[model samples]
Target: MREAYHKELESISEALVEMANLVGSAMGRATGALLDTDLRLAESVIDTEGQVEELQRNLEEQAIAVLARQQPVATDLRVVVTSLRMSADLERCGVLAQHVAKLARRRHPQHAVPRDLRRTILEMGQLAQRLMAQAAEVLITQDVDAALQLERDDDRMDELHRMIFQHLMDERWHHGVETAVDVTLVGRYYERFADHAVSIARRVVYLVTGEHADDYLPDTPVIH
Candidate 1:
């Protein structure tokens, strides 16, 4: 029974890793499409959203099966609950990517974001993607150290997001109001993407250590 329970745990973790990879790719492609003005890439991100949702559903079903069949207790119960939480986070990440794609589609003929802000937003998105991917690896391998290192990456994403916000606020103060709203919205999307990645990392911590990380916020303070 112990061996069977361990196998079920491993299966649950594997499913989570797959879900994380899908979310990471979606975020990366969304930012890439936005920066490059590639409508096709944006569309790809939009199209893949359904698959992410389906995967989340499947994971939830599998997790429920584990709970029903194994009746996990203590640490095992934490694994089941953490899987559900992480799946929800991954689903939200997909939704954020869809929003980015919608923005990209809206501005197909011209660039939606300003040139100065593009690089930073892209960097933030990339960091979020990296965190998602690394968090999956850490979870699958049960590497607490690697999972903890994701906090640093999340910090970098937060810094980029704050800088983007500052740029938007500066523009709002000095420049006209036309672009500020859209820019702020875009920054918010990216920031929320990073925030979701941090949430996934925290869930992984709970899965491994059986305790939730209290430090949910990234290292950097809000600048704007």
Candidate 2:
């Protein structure tokens, strides 16, 4: 009975890792769809969010069962509770990804990002993919340093976000208000996606060190 109880805890952790992977893929594909204006890809990413949410719900149910049936205490209790919280972060990541895809779908055929700023958006997307990958690794390895690196890397996402606004504010801007709004929303989605990814890493860091870490300061004024 004790062995089975530990196995259930391990399964919850495994499911969290899977959630990280799914959200990462969702954002990556959403980026592609946004850049290429591929409605099909955007639609697929939007569809996958439901599956990620399902995983979150399942993990939550499993965790609640452990709490009620096993009555875990100390480390075991922390593991169950932490898994539940991390699942929330993962769920938010999925929704953010879907928002990106929906933006791509809403502006199909015409690129959501202007040609001048597509490069910046692409960079942000790549950074998000890298961050999520590191987050997933941190989930499995519980490497505090890797988690810290994810926080540092998220700084790039912030920079890219500000760059989007800078382009919109420039005097030569001629993309008009509609496209500008789309670009603004896209930047925000990627920024928030990075935030949740870092949050997941911090969750792991807290789980491991029993304290929140990472305090790197930014030089530039971050956009929101």
Per-residue lDDT of candidate 2, residues 100-202 (tens digit): 9999999888888889998999999889988988998998898877877788788888888888889999999999999989888889988988998898888
Candidate 1 least-lDDT 10 residues:
215-224
By TM-score, who's the top model here?
2
Once fitted onto the true fold, the runs of candidate 1 whose alpha carbons sit more than 4 angstroms away are: 1-4, 171-178, 215-224
In the range 1-224, model 1's lDDT, one tens digit per residue, is 98998898888778888888888898889888888889999999988868888989988998898899899898789878888988888888889888988888888867777787778877877777788878778777776556667766677777887787678667355544655666777778877877777777777666666666665335435343
Candidate 2: how many backbone clashes?
Answer: 0
lDDT at 147, model 2: 78
Clashing pairs in 2: none
Error of 1 at 97 (Å): 0.9
